[model samples]
Target: MKLLLIPDKFKGSLTSVEVSKAFIAGVKKSGIPFSSHYIKASDGGDGFMNAVAHYKACISVQVISENPLGRPIQSYYLYNQESNSAYIELANASGMELLKPEERNPMLTSTFGTGLQIKDAIEKGVKNIYIGLGGSATNDGGIGIAQALGYSFLDKSGNRLLATGASLSKINSIDDTDVFEGLKQIRFFAVNDVNNPLLGKDGAAHIYAGQKGATKEMIKELDLGLRNLDVVIFDKYSFLYAELPGSGAAGGVAYGLKSFLGASYCNGIDFILELSGVNDLLTKEKFDFLITGEGRIDEQTLHGKLIQGVLALGVRKNIPVIAICGKLDIEKKELKKRGIYDVFEIQDSTKSLDYNMQHAADLLTAKTTEYFGLLLK
Candidate 1:
């Protein structure tokens, strides 16, 4: 039997590369004479630049930037001189992983760090910028980024405001007359997967802020701030983007780029897979099963994530897909109905969450052995 393995990072557990190694070791324990292939993939999250560098030649340009809470940090982005383009991952500077649980209040965080990275890239003569909008820790409606690029957010009294979620509701206007001239030449693209808008029930604050340490009251306030931001943009540019799909990505950073820099949005999974040549590989080889997964297989996994992209490939290429996850929250019947042959939850339920995370590799390997031992034999 031949198998193709593709997995995403298990978040706090194993990396995708480590997971693939565990799968190989487990299959060997099964004593099944099976050949396998691996695809290291990303859906434009934190590892976005790594995925692009895997298939293309690019230079890593390091910069001094700020963390989500405005602390100075060292970060980098991929640059291609030939295309005069740079690829930036928001998580490098503004990700949820950058902050401790106690430091994750969106009201106090900002995307100004990411904006600094962009400004550095622009100063380096990059004309095209692709930013992956995922795993951010802020909900400032993009005002922090705008501020970093030389725009100013002002209160009703025309006084400059600090760029943070708490200040969003106080922003009465934006001043961009002093923005970097190079910004006008830069073409920006937001690589996104989620379809949430910038505000309201399914919007960034309501849907994602809780993950970045927001209380219900904070969420309501952030949502109000985003609404105010939309109104201010409409007043200035005659354009409203709060309801735009994917605009809510990265805590309204996507919305910020679209409104401030004329950025466009693209599908993250499709872009990354195409870059990694997944379709070309499938066209060349016929595998019995395509194994793919991520940290958690939940309702969100069905929407524009790497698994959704891999599932589409499985359907198109007529390959059975067996997905393995560290934790499974979706119903197996639902996945089966959607054409996945099976879903494996590899954690030991008897163990504590910390224990399961620490031993994820062993659990994944054992699960792999059990499955292939029963099926391949």
Candidate 2:
């Protein structure tokens, strides 16, 4: 039998390639003769570069950038040669991983480093850029990114809008015509999974601002600040992006890219799958089953994530698809109706998150082994 294994990262637990390896080991242990095709995949989040790198061109370039807190830090951007563009996963520079739990203040953090990375790519003569907007620790409404591109945000008193989410309220004017003179010909395809707007109940501040240590009061302030800025941008440029899907992504970084850089939004998982050559691989091989998964399976997984993307492809090709997750939530019927053949959680039994994370590899191997034995029988 032949199996195609393509999984996303189990968040803090394991990577896609790591999970595939465990499954491969379990199948071998069960004495099952199987031809396995492994596709390390992502939803254009943190490991997008690694996924494409496994099948395409990936070059890492180190550049001086800023951290989530506006501090100078050095980070890398991955360049893909086949696409003739640079893939900048925003997390590499402005991710929550660079900050401590206590430092997870969206009110104070900035995406300036991400802007710097874009500038570096522009300088390298890359005309197309793909950006993954996730795992950021900022709510700056993309002010810092605009600053890096020479779009200055000034207050009524003519002072520059400072580097913080709270400072977005003071914006009185914007200048983008001459900013980043070398970027006029560049095109940006922003891969975003979130559909939140720039400001409102379901906007960036209210829905995701809390993940970055925003309090109720802070959420209110951020919402108002972003709303005011949205008004100004629309009045000046006649571009109303406040309600655009994914506009609130990466703390409104999507809005900035769309307004200033003429970026277009695309689903993250779809982008990754296309860039990784998954379609071409599937055309070259036939499989009895396709196994794909992520860290968790829930209602949210039905959204623009990895498993659903695989399911779509599987359905088109009339192939059965199953999933293995670190944790499975929701009704089995719900998953089955969605064309998922089965879902397995990697935990041996119920335990604390810490324990589950620590033993994920072992538990995953055992479960996969048991499943394979049943298949063999």
Top TM-score prediction, candidate number: 1
Worst 10 residues of 2 by lDDT: 48-57
* TM-score of each model, in listed order: 0.96, 0.91
Give Cα-based local distance difference scores for all models: 0.89, 0.83
- Total backbone collisions for each predicted model: 0, 0
Give candidate 2 regions above 4 Å deviation. Answer: 30-33, 80-84
Candidate 1, residues 94-199, lDDT tens digits: the string is: 9999998989999999999999999999888899999987889999877788888999999999999999999999989989889988787889999986778888
lDDT value for candidate 2? 0.83
lDDT of 1 at 103: 90
RMSD (Å) per prediction: 1.5, 2.3
**Model 2, residue pairs in steric clash:** none
